[model samples]
Structures are given as structure tokens and as C-alpha cells.
Target: MSGVDLPGAIRLVRANNVRALDPAPAMFEGMLRGWEQQQRSRLLARKTINDRLSLVRRFAEFTGTYPWDWTPEDVEAYFATRLSRGEVVWSTVRGQQGDLEMFCAFIADRRYGWAKACLEEFGRAPVQVCHDWNTAQHVAEFEGRPGRRAFTYEELQTFFDAADDRVEQIRKKGRKGVLAAWRDSVLVKQFYAYGTRRRETSMLDLSDLRHNPRAPHYGRLGALQIRYGKASRGSPPKRRTVLTVPEVDWIVPVIQEWVEEVRCGFSPGRHPALWVSERCGRLGVRRLDEVFAAIREHADLPAELDLHCLRHTYITHLVEFGYPERFVQEQVGHAYASTTALYTWVSDEYRNRLIEDALQRRLERGGGGTLMPQ
Candidate 1:
């Protein structure tokens, strides 16, 4: 495979080759290139490609060959290694397994003639070995601790107040403070107020905003059309979400200030993103991280309170306030009721209060104790 002929030969192999028997290194490289091309055309972003590549590299390293050589046993062994390294989170382990399984399916689709039967044979095999292993590990690690951690209303209020206070202080400093700090304050407010996912917040364009006529007299509600979410791709088929009056009231001013004052130098024609970097011309995940770091620094909140935590907080508050679970699920765009249920963690105190209220109501209705019971 000379340098001049390598590209052509690789293209030919990707177009015509299928059998995995006696697979050459060039063939494997060609397959990888083909996979890259497929991902690109399918609009699989770089972050996704990097994650799949990382998993593929790990599998290749374990098997001492390309991912094409992986068997069902190889898959199990790889996860076993993860367990051995003390990664006991079921969700995390299951996620890695899913990535590998998807990769296997991709390879099989491309190399159907070579390993179609073998792939089909193992496709039905349980992939939950990793999940089970991680579950056991989680149980053993947290043996004495409670199954779930539920924050009290007071605690929730304290966290939000602290975040809000920090934002106000940052904003008071004007442009003297870091641009990233200002950006993060906006994000924290958005997450708490709107219950938006990190990716949703990141993908938001200026054009998503609209006026809501039903906002209360004192405040304004805004409508946001979320076209791209986890379930779909390519910014179409948008769903409308009504932002609360308070959230709209807070975000509109900040956005206006950012556009007119802080963002005055950048041309709206050239840069259409709602959020932009002070240092770079474009904003992205890196900018999002910077915003998060600022929030973490100023709020004195726990390290676990990332952007996603805001969404969790929003749902938790809603459930605690007696919002219908179905309504909450629809607002958050959750596909399953069970998945939405995970966010509704009520504290023991609240549950006890509800029980007390019910007992009081029963007594008030003249439902007597032992002697007077009907």
C-alpha cells in the first residue's frame, strides 16, 4: 500500500469489501474512514464521534486487535474491567455498554457478509451484565446510606437564593467582571426558571424567543419554541413552551443588555448566536463550561450542581407544589412517565406533612376513634 495508491485502495475496500476473514489493517482503517464519513453525513456532531471513538479505542486495546475482532465475551470482559476500576454507577456502566453495542451494530451493518450471522446470534444476548454488576457495586458501596437524597424546601430555597445573590453581585460590577461570569449567571437563571437541559440551553438561538400575551399584569411570560431536542435532529418540528412570567422578566432584560452593551462590538449579521465568547468569535460547549465554572465559583454551591441540576431542581419544586406528574412530564419533554418520576424526590418531612393533613381532615369529618367509628 504505497502512499499514492493507499487512498484509492481504501476507498475501493470500503465500497466493495465485506468479509471479515483475513481482515487487513488497511481494511480496518478503510472501515473507520467509512464510519467517519457516515457519521458526518448523518449530522452526528464531533462530541458524539469522539465518544464513540473513545469506546472503540478502549475495545481495540483490550482485544489487541481492531473492534471488528470483538466478540460477545470481549464485550463482557471490557465492562468487567470497568467494574474492577471501581466504577460502580449502573447508569454510567450501562451507558458505556450501549455505546459499544451501537458501535457493534454499525460495524455489522458495514461488514454484513463477514459477520452478519455472528452479529445476529449475539444481538439478542442480554447486555445487562454490566448493569447488574454496577448495581451490585452501588448497593455494596452505599450499604448503610438511604436509597435517595431528597432536599428540603428550605435547602432548595437557600441554594436558589445564594445563586441569585451571586448573580446580582456579578451584574453590579458591570463590564469590570469577566464576560464568562455574566454568561453563566444568565444560564443559571435559565435553568432554574425554565428547567432547560444543558444541550437545549446551548442550542438556543435568539430567534427562539416570542412574546406571550397571557402573562400576568405585573410580569411578562415569553414563549420559546424548542425545535431541536434529544428525540430529534436538525432544528425543525419545534414544540412551544411557555416560560413563566418571572423567568421571561429576568431573561429579557439580561439579553437586551448583553446585545446592546456587552455585545455591542459584534455584528448581529455576522454572529447570530444568543451567547458569544469574549475571546473567540463563536460560542460553544467551552463557553458553556466557563459559564458553569463562574456559577460554581460565585454561588458556593456543591460541585454536583451542574447545569442539569437546575432542570432537576425545577422538576422537584413543581412536584412538591402538587403539580400533576403528567403535566410536568410534558413540560420537560420526557418520553416516559417513569423517567420523569425520577426527578420528583420529596423529602420525608413533606410526605409526613401530607399524611398529617389527611389525618386532620379525617378527624374534622367526625370519623371517630375506636368508640365512635361508623
Candidate 2:
């Protein structure tokens, strides 16, 4: 609002005949700078802002046209080409469409002054090219790859056993990584025990473990304060406190052992991170993945089973543990019950047990003596 409008500023430059070999590049640079400034002012994360900008740049490259010349047909053709390549999935296409629409909408907004700038300089302005008719629809709640499922109960046990065995094997061989092996072992245990995402786990500090008034039996480990939770659109990181559920309360001792014994062995006077590297820095998500992947390989799990499968395992196991759906949803910081439901994969044994319980309930109510025909 304080400076001359961007297009007007560009017009003044062109009128001056500064004699640049190519004025278009300069004009485009100015527009991008303005757009990025606007996005940053909205408090979007740097990664998200970059992603949106990249989408716009790719669209321009694909169409070989400026934003002012873009049309809905251009959007359709871009998506058509991406789909034909067989690399983009439905959800990815939908996300790309949404990002493109947001960029176009920003430029097209009258209050933003971009539309006016483009209209005056180029005789046209960018329009919302990605429309409902051309965009991918949100048809299903769960569109994750089919191979990515919760680890079965037996598999979960084997995975943890393998992690523990790594520590023992290192100690037996007089290897150098006994402490590091122990740390990775405990880290994987806490990952599933708490149902935390990689970033959330990476960002956690010792101070994040707090006491729950209702469950004081667990003392300082009664709850986990998640500081780097997944954020909502246009919002900062969301924070939530995941209580130590009765079932996963076993992690209380695991965290206690790490805090009391193993962690103290790390370089003293370091950062107050619960999980620290040998160099006295907080463990990052990439290292966390390597830890899980190594254990998964040793356990002979499928290649598709990644660290995120531990989260899926947590959600599915919670359902089998008979925690209320709403409680499970809240524990995992899901915004919606449907999103939580999407993570659940009930086991055949759990399903059969449920059927048996229903049959017993009917017998107690005197509603049946023999099995009913389907």
C-alpha cells in the first residue's frame, strides 16, 4: 500500500526505456518477489511457501506461458500430462491442484493489486485456472499406499526384540556402538509407544515430558507435551499433550531408564534433549529413520514397512486395546475421527473376539440358544 503498485512500477520502468536486453525477466523477478513477500506475511512455513512457488513455476514451464495467459484448459493439460506419466497419485494431483488454485486466487484477488498490475502491464491478469470441473475430487478418506499397513502383533514383538537384540549383539562383540545401539533401541520403542511422527519425536526435549494430575502414578512421564505437532492450514505448529494410556504405560519405565542411566552417559552440559547423539546434539528424523530401517531389516520385515508403519501400528493396536475411538483420535492429534479411522486396521483375532463377545451377550440376554442363519 505504501509503494507504487507493482505493475505501475513496471510500467514506469518500461516507459523509461532503460534498454535492458530482456525486460520480461526483470518483470517476472519482481512479481515473484512480491508474491513470496505476500506469502511470508501470511505466516506460512518456509517449506510450504517454497512448495507453492515451485508449483507456480512448474505450471509456467509446462504451459510456456505467463500467468496472465494461463487458462483452465492449461491446468487440465498439465494434470493430464502428469497423470499419463503414471508417477502422480490421486491425492498428489489433488494437492497440486489446490496449491495452483491458491496461487492463482491470490493473484486474482482485487485487494492484492496483482490483478491490476498484470491487467495494466499485459492487458490481462491471472485467473483461477484450476476449477472444480477440472480438478481431482476427494473420493476416499484413505488413499495411502496399500502396502503401508500396521505391523501385526507378532511382527511388532519381533521388531522390538530385534532392536533389543542389536544392543546385546553389539555389547557381546565389544563393538563401539553399545551406547548408540541402546539409544536407537529405546528411541524405536518410544516411537510406537507414543504414536509420534518423526518430526514430533525429533523436536522433543526432556522438559516436554510432564506429569498428568489424573495419572500421577507415572510421575514425570505421565504425559508427553508434543510441541511440534502437525499444523493446520495457515497455522503455526499445533501443540497437544498425549497422556500415558494404561496400555502403553510400559514406556514410563523405558523412558525412565534412558533418562536416569543412558542419557546421563552422553556428554554432560549438552542440550536438554531426551534423545541425544554421541556428539551431544538432538537426534534428527533422518537418523531416526536409519535406526528403524536397520532394525526392520534385521527383523526381516517387508521393504514397504517404514517408520510411519509404527504410527499405523500404534493406531491399530489402540483399537485392539479397546480404547474409545475418540480417545485414540485425540491421543494421535488427529483433527477428525474419520482421519483416525483411516489409520485403524483391526486384526482378524480382534474381529473374531468381538463376534464371540456379541454372541455371549445375546446368550446372557436370552435372545438366542442356537446360531442364527445369515
Candidate 3:
């Protein structure tokens, strides 16, 4: 048997009891591989492919059935049990459903022959289980937690001051990690300077620092060439250049100081990461969140104010600085103007000022002194 031709032996065995062989597992594996190949052909990111695969496996495990046996009821019951446990959020459930939908769509597509394979092996095939009835709806432009909002101007000032003070306090005590402290302090400033997501910040390289012709005063730090902007479904990461406008140009000096002085103190053989760790590697996304959390605590800011709040603050301030909506959208690398608007959390004072300016313009136009409710 050990020396027998494997394909011949398999054929002889299948001729006897194909059902006894229980080919469901092997058929499922083939379908998964086909789905992965399809995703790869479509140029989906590796992480995204892995995430979808993991979700499919989890759903199968939950239902005690293979993809061939999955039904809409299984999907609904899985989510129901999850929600009852209070372990997952609506957003997370929505993402899981999206992943499952893509997987099921792949297995059900006749072009892939997964349906034929499943039907021959187990007498059934996978079908789409995710639908609007079992999934969350995108009702509002803002689906984020209610507590997550942009930092106010005063709060932003306090947060920055706290970061700066930490560095100063370390230096005054002749601490060994003053360079690290200085790096964290400047990194937080850079986060606000550019409305960058955490992973986007982590992927920055020295060469990404570019100069904008219109912002000569900012020198080589006038813009950031973001090479790893968020990718759409089945697409590579989107790339964009975020310019340092005059309003946040003050960050130019801070970044210059970090690159010229403090970053140099790190291991010289390290990668060209904008933020490097003491271990001579690029700072990771988790470390970035930890740094922000520490600074936020020291600043006595709201516990709910995560690093994303910095991005919100940037968008809010840019609108207050009178930048055009289109320009803001481009700088933030948002595909739609409405997406950029979602990040903006302008202050009440800014809204009042806008109202005042509107009234002034009306008076200048001699509108018979009509006042309108805002």
C-alpha cells in the first residue's frame, strides 16, 4: 500500500464508498483555496484575505457545519449568540458579515466550480447567508461612538503642553530616555499636524517627507507623501500627498528638530521610519496608541479621547481656518467630501463666527437689515 500509486488507490477506494470517505473537509479546503486564489487575482491585500478566511472558519465552527451546510439561520443565530454575550460591537459584527458575504459569494460563483465540487462531495453547496435582514445598516454619516469627538482648542493645547512638559521633566531629571520622550512628544504633534490614521503614521519613512513649492517656508517638511493610505475593497493601498498648510506650518520646525537632532540619537542602522523605537526598528501601531494614551492621561483629558481624536481635531481646525472643503478632502485623502465632513467636529464658537460673518455679508449687500435664525 505504501508503494501503491496514490491517485490509482484513491480512485479504487472512491469506487467502493465515496460517501464513506466523507469528502466534505477536502471539498471545503478546495473551495477555500479557490476563493483565496480569486481574491489574490483581484489584488486584495494579504491581511484582508486572511481576515476573511478566519471569519469563515469561525462561522463554520460556531454552526458545527461546513460551508456546504451553512444557512441564513446559522448566520443569524451566530450573531444573536454573540450579541447576547455582549462581546462584540455592531461595527465589528458588520465587518464580520461583510467578510462572510465575500467568502460565500466566492464559493457560490459558478465560474469557480465550488458549487459543483460541494454538490458532488456533500450533496449541497454554500449559499449567501448575509443579507440586510441580518446585518447592520449604514443609517448615519457618523456611526462612531458618541463619546468620540474632536478635542477642543483648549483641550488640544493642554494635551500638547502635557507631552512637552513630560519631555522637559525627563530632561530636568537627567533621564536616560529623554530622546525617546522627545520623540513621543514630537510624534503626537505630527499626528495632529497631519490627519493621519495610526497605521499611516507607522508606515512613514524619511523619504515621505517632501517639499511643497507653494510652502517654501516649510522647506523639505512641507508635505507628507503617504504611501499607505487606506485601500478600498480588493485594491492596493491608496497613495496621496498631504501638504503642510500655513495654519499648521508650526509643525515644520518641530519635525525639523526631531529629524535633525533627536532621531539621529537612535541607532544609526535603523530603517528610515519617521518614528523609531529604542530597539532600532520602526515604531509599531500598538506602541503609537500606547504613547498617545500615556500623554492623554498626563494631560488629564477625557479617557475616551483616543489618537483618532487628533485626526478629528486637524479636520475641525482646518475648517475653522477657512480652508476650502475640496482642499481639506484632498489633504485628508478622503474619497468623498462627505467622508471628510464626518471627521469634522467644529466648535460652537466657530459656528457663531460663521453666522456673524454671514450677517456681515448680508449687511454689506444691503439686504434691508433682515436677520434670520441660524
Error of 1 at 119 (Å): 15
Ranking by TM-score: 2, 3, 1
TM for candidate 1 is: 0.69
Model 1 score (lDDT)? 0.58
Q: Is candidate 1 or candidate 3 better by lDDT?
A: 3
Q: Model 2 RMSD to the real structure?
A: 3.3
The clash count of every prediction, one per candidate, is 0, 0, 0
Q: Is candidate 1 or candidate 2 better by TM-score?
A: 2
User: What lDDT does each candidate get?
Assistant: 0.58, 0.85, 0.84
Candidate with top lDDT is 2
**Reference-based lDDT, residue 12, model 3:** 22
The residue-level lDDT of candidate 2 at 88 comes to 84
Q: Write model 3 residue lDDT over 60-86, tens digit each, in one string.
A: 889988987888999889988998998
Which segments of candidate 3 are over 4 A away from where they belong? 1-22, 364-374
Regarding lDDT, does 2 or 3 come out ahead? 2
Candidate 3 displacement at residue 84 in angstroms: 3.1
